[model samples]
Every structure is written in C-alpha cells, then in structure tokens.
Target chain A: MNAPRVIDVRGLRYRYPDGTLALDGVDFHLCAGECVALFGANGSGKTTFALHLNGLLVGEGSVRVCGVPLAASVSAGDLALVRSKVGLVFQDSDDQLFLPTVLEDVAFGPANLGLTPEEAAARAKVALEQTGMAGALHRAPYHLSSGEKRRVALAGVLAMQPEVLVLDEPTTALDPPGQRDLIALLRTLPQAKLLVTHDTSFAAALATRAVFFERGRVAGEGGLPEIVNRFHWSR
Target chain B: MRSAARETWIVERWSRGSSPLHSLDARAKLAALAVYLLAIASTSAWTQAAVAGYAVILSAALAASRLPVPALLARAALILPFSATFALITWLSGDATRALALVEKSFLSGLAVLVVIAATPLTDLARALEAFRVPRSLVLVIQFLYRYLFVVADQAHRMRMAAACRQGIRRNARPRFHAAAGAVGVLFARSWERADGIYRAMAARGFHGTFPALAPTRFRTVDGVFLCGFALAALAVRLML
Candidate 1:
C-alpha cells in the first residue's frame, strides 16, 4: 500500500529453548506515529511479541520493519541500521543499565552508530536533558532509585533517536510518582510506540490502539475505547 | 544516588593522581615495578635497615602524589596474607637474617603494586595493554569485566538483602540457606538475561567488539621525570645497602 507499513508481522511463531510455546501466530501492524498497547496477563505472549518486532527473538514467519526482512539476507550493517531505527527498552532498568554512568550509557547508542565522539556526547546530553536526567549524568546507574533508573534507561534509548520505541513492562515496580513520570514522558516522544504492559490502567492512560493477547494468539485488536467496551461486554 | 560515604571512599581510595607518578607510561611502570621487585627479592637477608629506608622513600613518593596515605596503607595491609606466607617460608628455613629480609622484601614488593595502581588509572592501564599491542578482543573483555564486575557485585548485594528480608525467621538455618540458594540462582539467571540485553543494545548502537577511545592520553614531560626519579631513588637505596 502507501509506502508499505512501518511495522508488519505475519504468521510469527516462537517457542523457548525449554519448549514453552511463548507465542503462536501473532500478527500486528502499525502506521507511523501510532501509540499501541499490547495487553495481556503474564505468559500471554506480550513480551515475546514485542521481542519479535525488533528482531531480538526470531520466529517462524516473516517480520518486516520499515520494509526490511529480519533475516540473514539483510547484511549485518543494514541490520544494525534497522535496529537503530527500532529502540527497545526492556522491562527492568537494571538490564538496560550496565554502564558506569548515565551519560556513558545514554551515549552508548550514538557511539555505536558511528557518530563522532563529540556528536555522540552532544546527543547523549540532549537525550538525558529530555528525560530530565541531565544533572545525574555522572552518577552510576546502580545508585539511582528505581524510577530514576527507568528514566535513565529511557534516555539511553532516546539518545539513539529511533523511529519506533518498544517498551516492555515500562511501568512495573514503580511508585505512583515514578509511574506518572514515565507516563508523562511517554506521551511526549514523537515516534510510533509499542508498549507491552500488564497494567490495564497504564494501557488506558497511554494507548490509542489496544491489542489483547491470550496464550500467544492475537485475541483481538481495536481502538482503546472499542477494546475496553468489548472487554467489559465479554466479562 | 551513591551515598556520600561510598562516593567519598571511591574518590579517596580509587582515584589516582595526575602527578608525575600518575603519568608514567604503563609499560615503563610495569618494567620499573619488576626491577624494583627483583632488587628487593635478591637483597641479602640482613638488610632490614636498608629495606626500612626504601619503604620510607616509597611511601613518601606515594604521599607526594596526593593519594590518601591512610587509604593506601590500609589497602597494602590487606595483601599481607600472600606476603605473610612467603615471609613464613623464609623464617621456617632457620635463617633469622633471611626471614627479616624476606618479610621486608615481600612487604615492599606489595607496596610497589599499590604505587602503580595509585599512580595509574584503570583506563590508562588498559591503554598500557593496548600499547603492548594486546589483542583488541582480550582488551575489550578485560575492560568489560572491569566495568561490570562492580555492577554485578552491587546487584548481588541487593539480592542478598532482599533474600534476608523475605526469610523472616532470622535463625531458620534451613530456609535461610534455601532462600540464599534461590537468590543466587535468580541472580545468575537475571545476569545472563541482562547480558543478552546488553549485547543487543550494543549491537543496535554499533559496537563491533572494539571499544573506541573517547579521549586519548598523551605522554608528556612529567611521565619521563617520574620514571627517572623512581628508578634513581630505588637504585640509590638498593646500592647503598
């Protein structure tokens, strides 16, 4: 259709090494700048589904992001380029933050993108500033509180300036203030966002489109209000 | 936020100086430390007076470099276990003179390592390895290991605390161990998963195994002067003995 889809998935299936069928025949589509929420209870394939979008977990069928296939036919350099376009923020901030300091972690993406040191540092500064983490640049990620670590982790991805942002359980284990801060920040990023979360209230607050996942299949998909109404009716 | 106490401890104990001692090329310092050790080790057994004088001069140089004296001494003291064994062997040989000399030599050699670390930053040490043309992969592994070792340690400490809190019965030895083992397993699994995430993030960012130097260190006049002084002082003490 019009310039292909930003994210296109077809017949995606996956099983863990332990033979757990984490995802089965999940299909999804997102246009530019849409905010979509992936909702499910634990083990409902939400995280597995999100992992597929970025080529982090390979599955049975095709996954094309910005029209490039997620396979070996795509050269390594090109795959990296594709990855740069798709930013994935993991569920735990500790996993995202391995660097000694916030600035170094935030700059990690740009530095790997072949930007000059100066350019990378500037981008990192801007991204941290965006996340309201500028003053904490020199501080270690381990030292930060749970909310601050989350914000810094987001800043690290934000520095790369990816076109699509995929967040897995972005609000788990946060206090009310931390959760509110994350929600407020999510609303302001100018990219198509795929939010994978178990928090129903959080999905209601941020997602325009909702995809309900159950035992690996796409149970249903619709706009937020439509999905909410349908969910209530079915209940 | 790192507590003020931890931050202060790091800056005081971990941060090296920018003085003459700090700037010696890593290779040169490594060589110097080697020669210093050899000299100390080979000295005659009755050289306590000479060794004491050597220690004073070396400690003074450490002080001159602005490294906190008490912290440096405390760290040096921690290494006494390995040194004590060497000293013990020499003493057990039934030569009183040799025993005193061996203890002094071991202590001084340990002090020499402390001097190098106090003088050179860890990054410079990496650069020193690079200077010797160490494989990029090896250097990268070492750099990552150094960077993440502290992180993993901190993560382990927190997990330990959480396990302690949950076990409730402070004295239930069986459940406490069960909790501890489970926590260790979780930490291992979590770190493994985090390693994967870190690799993906690095790949997405374009890390190709080699770490690019953000800032290049330059060898300057101070580097040369420090090496010469250290060598000369060491020589004067050893020869005069």
Candidate 2:
C-alpha cells in the first residue's frame, strides 16, 4: 500500500507585491518518509513554494498539510497548528538562529506550542543530542562555526516535532565535509523533507525523487538522475 | 566595528561564569540595581561622600562577579561623552560642582548596570523584566534589537570592506564620503530584508508574540537575602551619607 500524503498542493499560485508571478499553477505532494528535492534556478519560485507550506505567504491555491486544508481565510489558531506541523529551515542559518544561545533557540518552538519550561528544555535537549549539538547548548549562536550553526538551526526545527521539513538551500555555506555531514544527518531524520537546492550531488544523495521548477511551475518530476540530466542541473 | 563585536562576546562570556553574584536570581539583581540607581539619582551634588559610597558598592559587586575590573571600568567610561555635553552646560551655568556630580552620577550608574549585566545573561535579565510585568512588546523589541545588532554590524563591516576593495586606497575624502552614504542606504535595505526573513522564520516556528524562557528561575533564600541587604545598604547610604 502507498504511504499517506503529508503535504498536498494543487495549482498553487502566488504573486509578489510588485506583480512578480512567483508560483503559477504548481501541483505537488509528498508522502510520509519521503525526501523530495526541488531543483531550479534562482527566482524560480522554489523558496516561494516552501514558504506557502507553513502559511508564511498566503496565495491562490489549495495547501493541505497533514490533511488539514489551509482555507483562504485561515485563522491564527489554524496557522499556528499548520506551522507546528511544518518546520521550515531558511536558506540562511543566521536568519533562523536568532535566539541568544543554542538551547534557547532550540526550545523556542516547543515553548511556543504551550509546553512548560521544563518540558520545552527536555525536548530541546533531545533535539540537540540528535543533532550532535548538546555540548554547545550554552554557547551563543554567533560564536559557532558555520557547520555548527547549520546543525543548531536544524535542531531548532527538530524540536518542534514537525511531520514535514522544508529546507531551503541547506548546504549553502558548508565545506565538503560539512555537506557530507549534513547528508548523513538528514538521512537519519524520519520526517518527510523537501529540499530546495542547486547542488545536484547533494540532492542525489538524499532525495528519493526530484521535481524541476521553471518560472513558478513544476516543469518535470522524476528520479534524481533524470531530473538532473533533463534540466542540465549538474555542473 | 569588529572590536565592538569582540567586546560584546567577552561580556557574554563573563555572564556565563559561575560566581556568587552570577548565582543570584536575575530579578533580585534587577531590584538591587533599581535601589542603587535611585540612591545615586537622589544624592545632592555637594554630597561627594554619597557618590563615593555608590562607586564603592558597584566596585564591590564587580569584584564579586570576578570579571576584569579594568575592562569594565573602561566600558563604563563610554557614557561620559553623552553626559559631558550636559555637564558642560551645567558648568557654563556657573554650577561646576553640579556638573561634576552629573558626570560622576552617570558614570556610576553605567558601572552599576554593567555589573548586573556582566553577572547575568541578557536572556535571563529579559526574562526577569517580563516577570516584573514589563510590557511584552517593549521586551520583545529589546530582545530582537540585542540579538540582531551583531548580525547587522557584521553586514556593515563586510560592506565597508567590499567598498574599500573596489574604491582602492585614495586620499579623496569627497568620493569616499559619497561612497559611504550609498553604502548606508544599501545596508538599510539589506537589514530590512533580513528583518522580514527573520520574522518569517519566527512565524514558521510558531512564535506568535512573546518569547518563552527555556528554564524558569527560582528565587532562593540567598536571592532574598541579597535583595534585602543590597536595598537596605543603598537606602541607608542615600539617607545617611
């Protein structure tokens, strides 16, 4: 039997305030425990599509996360529920790791979910241990190396206990070893992941399938190698 | 600019150290600070003994914190420039003693704040402020400003370096000034975009309005004793000295 769909987007369309059509008639879905790669050039609406999953950017189209439909006039409570279900790690780790220390940053999401301080800290500790950042819990985020910052950002999202993870350009500022470490780390996570990236090799390593985006629409969807070859995504 | 960031990091490191002053509850320390400031502010300009008393108290607290004394004193001097402007006005108005007192009180107040901040992490201090019923909006603004100041500083530093590389080494002040003005505009725009991105990230993680603390602080017996002792000492100095 096929797995359940964690995210279902049908004809998702979005336009910027300046009249730029970011996402146009895009249809997508992710099954449980599946990792999908979104491949496209810059400004191809990859990040825009990811933003919609958590209701950050409301646009025309239907977005149902974990079978909960995001209505046109979604209430704050509904958005909060959807946000808790979908964790997004932005392209810049600095943008995500705004809290003073690693532990507080990780605990932020859990605490927002109405968890008590002790409960949130416990969840944060587990997430830090999972991300191999337990030792740096008290250290300031700015003092960490680029790799450590990335892990802590991922830990922050993990603490939310989301069913879907949308990571935009996760391997931006890492060396070869950093990229390899991220691939290994991402492989162990159980949530359904959608990675928007330009690195075909990194995508090939973790993505079970790939979708190609062109000018705010899904141009093609297939296996990794096929998508890479069709779009000349490989350097 | 890099030096400023480094200095902030050093202070943050100091806050994390284990010491008697650091162990006190943040709310207690904040109360003590309030008492100390009130004593200093109410002191008469002619009462040099009271000003000296405030300085000694702050120095004792700083020593207890085990932080570098010279470095913190130097940082406290940063307020002199602003205070000096008002002090100069008072001096010109034929109140030299009052002007001296203005500088002295400002410096002592700055040192007292630095002592408290050096002993307690800013996150804990902010939590204490919230516990004291400070408006959530104001507290959030302070938290965000402190958190992002370094990021914005680093961006500005990088922009300066890049502009320097493109402009080359020249003694032309006019062109350099114009370039700097343009860079400021770019920096503002970039910062605005970054702020938007940060808000989006926060919303995605379910941050509605308030920031929640990771660990709730408990006010122990030691904290109560510290608050009472400090407040009594400050009040006695203000009334008697």
RMSD of each: 4.5, 2.7
Off by over 4 Å in 1: A1-5, A136-139, A225-235, B1-13, B16-46, B85-89, B118-121, B154-190, B208-210, B213-215
**Chain B in candidate 2 has what TM-score?**
0.87
lDDT of 1 by residue, A61-117 (tens): 888898888863667776777778888888877767766567878888888888988
Cα lDDT tens digits, model 2, B120-187, are 98889988998898987888789788888888989888997888788866888998898889999999
* Model 1 alpha-carbon miss at residue A18, Å: 4.2
How far is A158's C-alpha from truth in model 2 (Å)? 1.6
User: A-chain TM-score per prediction?
Assistant: 0.93, 0.98
Determine the C-alpha RMSD for candidate 1 after optimal superposition of all C-alphas: 4.5
True lDDT of residue A200, candidate 2: 86
Model 2 segments beyond 4 Å from truth?
Answer: A75-78, B1-4, B45-48, B80-103, B169-177, B209-216
Give TM per candidate.
0.82, 0.91
lDDT of 1 by residue, B1-241 (tens): 3344454336434544577566567767766676677667666644667877688777766765677778777767756777677778877887667666656676778877877766765656777777767886787678566666656677887886776676665775787777778878988987787688778666555567766663555766766676676777777777887
| Complex DockQ per candidate | 0.40, 0.73
